[model samples]
Target: MTTLQVEGLTKVFGRGAGRTVAVQPMDLEIDTSTALGIVGESGSGKSTLARLLVGFETPTAGAIHLDGRPISRMLSMPRERREFRRAVQFVAQDTFSAFDPRRTLRDAVATPLRVLREVTGPAADAEIRDVLGLLQLDPALLDRYPSQVSGGQRQRFALARSLVVRPQILLCDEVVSALDVSVQGAVLNMIRDYCETYRVGLGFISHGLPATTFIADTLLVMRHGAVVETGPTEQVVDRPEHPYTRTLLDAYRRGPRRVVAVDPVA
Candidate 1:
């Protein structure tokens, strides 16, 4: 049940001596219906890899497969490209910018259904309500503008939009980083619930390792545009093998009677 596989993936920007390496060649796998976390510091190429996987960016070299089909190969056809776009979705960091300012949250979330022809009739209203409800959002607020909602609500609405399409894999890029701790926890629970209910896979990318630790089944640590460590979530958290992984774990540690005995730095 390996839903997504990335092998020898690399993404470089610029050229010659001034070139920058965004992501060094790396290999990883995300199993179906499970959560995988990519943890790293800023500029670690975590987001670069995510963009490549979700088709937002092409890789400089290497391969990625979605359910056994290579991403590069899949992009060559119009029909397959459309299918690929619908099958995988991304949640951006800035909720406001992700949507059109002219559109209400309802229109933004409903655009996908309208495009895919998956929903129609008077029941479309109910579909919106149901999706909002799944995100613990009030149905009444669906008509409100994004500016009228709180940051948490805006993020939730963004999430609702992605889920409205019922994608097979969700690529969440620091989806909760801008929210308060309480809001973050609630959103995380909702994501976990949605994945369980629909049996869909999730790829969570974040610089904050602690935030993702509760939801991810597997952990991949990246640094300097390369993967530093990866393994089962608990194993990686409990026994991190790389210096950068240790640094991230240390950053989340509360200190003095830390919940976990991890090195402060590596």
Candidate 2:
């Protein structure tokens, strides 16, 4: 029953003539077991929104609440801030930059456990193995560095690093965009499985609507910095109200057999 809410969130960069509104005023909420999909072409504000939710980016004007408790107060308090960070996790698309080439994946995954959760020694080792097993990854892969694994493996490892934290809400930004069609499908299915199994709220961000269709319970479509459409996944995909949404559905219909391999990064 953990709920994360954001209201009137806005982000503006630069000033005057060079100013750019990365995100417009917006509101969104997600709780445990709710899968919310956010889709838009490249340059859309979905990524910015994700950053804002996770506190990686500060909002120009807005408020965030966790279970009706303002994030402002939670963040201001040291112990609450630490706890709040653990409740939300972000998995990024770029795996190449996430880990150190010299260290084993095991060490990388174990850092957060030791630092944030204060889990170490045998407890941390068991936790790492358990999370990896859930991802269907072998414990053997932990010995390998980031360079040694395939893109799909590296991506899953990135996710495992976050899942090791056992977050209540998980946000992924294009975690499957770089994989092959087959690999992408497996990763997407894995995403669905892990989130559901853990009862975690999911904020899935992607450029293609088709990618979100099978996984999202609620879909929010964005154009530029504005939300063009938002509703149950079936309604938005089937009876698209906006012209831009229709265009997305049309593109999906006309796409090739590997339909999920759509990255309209416009």
Candidate 3:
């Protein structure tokens, strides 16, 4: 199983007057077959942490290691960079705009297989169709552009694209916040199943506690760009140590549980 370790990971935007700290220095590690749920309100830096872990945002300072090797030094080499990307993926919050409206869904999925895995032509088509089938998405949707489908469809398609690469670590940022409860359930199930079946590590970042806890076994609560509390999902949910975590849990209970949407434990 792949293990991703980060120490003193930090992200700061700008310098001097305009400086803003997106993610405070944090230490964490994740392994395949485990789900780490990141919960926080808007601007809490949960997304920033996901972006940093996936290399979408370079850390202002800190060190990252994948399977004991330094990520930065590995990324500098083309071979290792491609390998690193194939192993880690980030599913962003905005699934709609995450795609290019100009390209057909088939092209979008095929791009990764062609680039990262070096599969081409008929092989790419085969893999794309297979992943679509795995996600239970209709193959016909592959011919349509991103705008031609519903939000749920786009989200599934995006998921299929990521799964096509067979990533070892999947970092999802607020994937279910927009979809209705029904659609959310479907997407969440698909993600959990894939991760379980493939022994893939998951980083679920979201503001919604239920949605995040539904997929994550471990909880990481954040506020003001720093971690507030973290531990087993049940402990943090039932016996939150920090006041902020208790506030999150209290707010969550006051709302519609929708606990039936997606159950975490298989």
Cα TM-score per model: 0.91, 0.93, 0.95
Greater lDDT among 1 and 3 belongs to: 3
Candidate 1 vs. true structure, TM-score:
0.91
- Sort every candidate by TM-score, greatest first: 3, 2, 1
lDDT scores for all predictions?
Answer: 0.81, 0.85, 0.87
Structural RMSD, model 3? 2.8
Q: Residue 207 in candidate 3 has what lDDT?
A: 97
Which lDDT tens digits does candidate 3 get at residues 1-266? Answer: 89999999999999999999999999999899689999999999998898888777789999889999888877889999999999998788697678998999988988988899999988788888888876778889889999998888888888988899989999999888998787888788888888998899998899999888788999999999999999999889989889999898999999866534443211
Ranking by lDDT: 3, 2, 1
Error of 2 at 87 (Å): 0.3
- Residues 102-184, candidate 1, lDDT per residue (tens digit)? 88888888888767546866677778788887787887777888889899899988998888888888889999889877787
Better of 2 and 3 by lDDT: 3
> Which one wins by TM-score: 1 or 3?
3
The superposed Cα distance between candidate 3 and the true structure at residue 139, in angstroms, equals 0.1
Backbone steric clashes in candidate 2, count: 0
Which portions of model 1 show Cα errors greater than 4 Å?
255-266
The TM-score that candidate 2 achieves is 0.93
Q: What is the lDDT of residue 22 in candidate 2?
A: 88
Tens-place lDDT digits, model 2, residues 99-214:
88999999989987787798999999999999887666888988989899888889988999998888999999998888877678777777788889879999999987666886
Tell me how many clashing residue pairs each candidate has.
0, 0, 0
Model 3 pairs whose backbones collide = none
